[model samples]
Target: MSSRFRHAALVGKYQARGIQGPLEEIAQFLVRQGLDVSLERDTALNTGITDYNALTHAEMGRECDIAIVVGGDGTMLGSARQLAQFGLPLVGINQGRLGFITDVPIGHFADALAPMIAGDYEEERRTMLEGGVWRDERLIFDGFGVNDVVVSRGPTSSMIELKVTIGDEFVGNFRADGLIVASPTGSTAYALSAGGPILHPGIAAWVMAPIAPHDLSNRPIVLPDVGRISIEVAQGRDASVNFDMQGMASLLPGDRITVARSSHQVRFLHPLGWSYYATLRRKLHWNTGV
Candidate 1:
């Protein structure tokens, strides 16, 4: 049978040692399935693989029908962010420890991917965070957050004070080590570790969790993914804000970081019958006592 995807982009964790063998194998497997394969430019350069065509993010976005990301969730996060603008669908193969989005195992990649290439899979859309730092009503820095946006203190041993506002309404003052603004997709990420509840991907919501607050009353709150949420650095030295993998450090006291749902959503292709609960159980070891 002919593959649904005419071309596939292979993105790998370029920093991983001995990644070339698996990458080459996957590329060959895709080719055998009657699909053309190309390597992401950096992956080809870093891994020293020249067999397939090397394409930039833009080139891949324009040419490839699907992207196969090989690495941990971090690698997937990077690829998703870069390719999200093109509205491309991604498939993740787990080469790292925790495979949240990268659910396909490296050992069983052939078994899991063959059918997916033939358009036999489930597609899930995940939202992202779009945010920026405003200083004196002027936009300073802006970026995208796949997991969560963090506002934290710098090299000082003091907790930063943040003024939280949800769509022009004053929430409260929080004095904490930091603050995390996570999407439903990010609920299982840093926010989960910071005591935030797990939010189902089907829900269109965001979770705001305090990081070691001075007052115990400051707790995690789930907010609807509507309107803009503003967090201002009320008081702190060298406060900073992070948009998932990217961040701006040494922010001023009056800097306000405005976060809202991004217009673009990332599409992830999963194997048939893939369940969120099953992933949570396996990754978090929730089935241990059950």
Candidate 2:
């Protein structure tokens, strides 16, 4: 059996326009539950709490039993990248629209925590991707992504050309605006908008989707998680790589980017009543009463 987490850390994007209220409520809720709650410095200031340990992102991941993200999916994505290897479960409280990763609504926060504290909920382990930027055979940037890694043209020129290969098999050369290498957890983000299929979270696969492919026949392809993908920039003045929306190293012509599944996984907490399809309907507004 897995161990239960007793110390909970609260993290939020306090500078994100308006998030102070929810952060305070979550912090108070955790304290009320008798759980040890530590707040990020910015969040603590926003909540008028001063006797708190001001932790950096990495410190929060290392010290916390579980991390509670009280912002949009963007905030959750940033936190996940830092916390993935820490093996701590994360619970996201939605403060933004269409929160695929930030699953819990603000109103349901208390209800969700009830069972989570008692260890009555399930942990969903999600796969992550490790990407390396190689410039002239020298490794430049090594990073990981919980959602998707995007390669796109920078401020300078025209469309980019990318030659992709998967596990020693040449996939195709794509001439397009960009490319998205996504995990099943990220299928609903950029990949979904790029006409990529939605993959179930349990699937151990990655979706390679080309954005605005010049050839209509060159569609998104899903491959085994264990497969290694190499993307070479054939022609482009300025191209760049981003991991889970966080900008990484810039790529020039002839740069090669390799991506594969990372052995590390991230644990996410879901309330016993949480359902993926239900979140889809609520966030997507699938149906409305007449």
Candidate 3:
């Protein structure tokens, strides 16, 4: 084990069959290497491992120097919110389709494990968005979003009117499906489907993309991540702000949603040879037509 890291935490998708055997193997390997390891409670129970079991992500976070998530980006996203507070370096062992965030391949994790345990890895700091819905002049919903925050007419097939502004400047009123406020990490998600530009992870930027605008002139835009993005539900029937595709809070007419880059920065550890462009190319199949 590296001097910088003495303990590690294992987190993965709940009830995922492909991960259990690897989880058992990894836990035993870490123990043999003389490094402390904790398993996320549900994962531990699912895998039948008893050592260093943690009931909560917070417990694992406080006790571990590094966290290795063993599933897809969705699992990583869920883990990010809970474990980000502890500021530990996080990595992943991919066990899901299209593992954008979880870049490590389980087939070669054994080869990489020794170097990783020795602190031979690279880390990138990814920014998250602090989003909230303000109703009656106070925060009604608040959370950290690793990807995009969406405001829309929830469960309805009709369009809604939304007034959007960034940093005290008036943008316009958009009558459409909804608006997507995305961090750089989210540029590939819903924002991408809405014609938003792909932003490099190192870029200090965010994107404002309209889901389906009535006016085609209303285009997707990129903005500095430093300021406030305000979205007001001008005309809608029980609209809501969905954070990271996880939870939603209702928004009445005249309710405002604000999003900005959070002060909390989460670090993702990558194996030494990992490349962002390589991941994009492989996942997107950009070379297929050639």
Better of 1 and 3 by lDDT: 1
Worst 10 residues of 2 by lDDT: 45-54
Residue lDDT tens for model 2, 101-162: 88888888998876787677767889999989998999988888999989998776688999
Q: TM-scores, in order shown? A: 0.98, 0.93, 0.94
Report, for every candidate in turn, its global Cα lDDT versus the true structure: 0.94, 0.84, 0.85
lDDT of 1 by residue, 1-290 (tens): 33488899999999998899999999999999999999999999999999999999999999999999999999999998899999999999999999899999999999999899998999999999999999899999999988999999987659999999999799999999999999998999999999999999999999999999999989999999999999999999988888885889998888999999999999999999999999999999998978
Candidate 3 runs further than 4 Å off: 1-4, 45-48
lDDT of model 3 at position 280: 92
- The C-alpha local distance difference test score for the whole of candidate 1 amounts to 0.94
In the range 186-257, model 3's lDDT, one tens digit per residue, is 999889999999999999998899988999999999888988999999998867788888666567888999
For every candidate in turn, the CA RMSD to the true structure comes to: 1.4, 2.1, 1.8
Model 2 segments more than 4 A misplaced: 1-4, 45-48, 288-290
The candidate that achieves the highest lDDT relative to the unseen native structure: 1
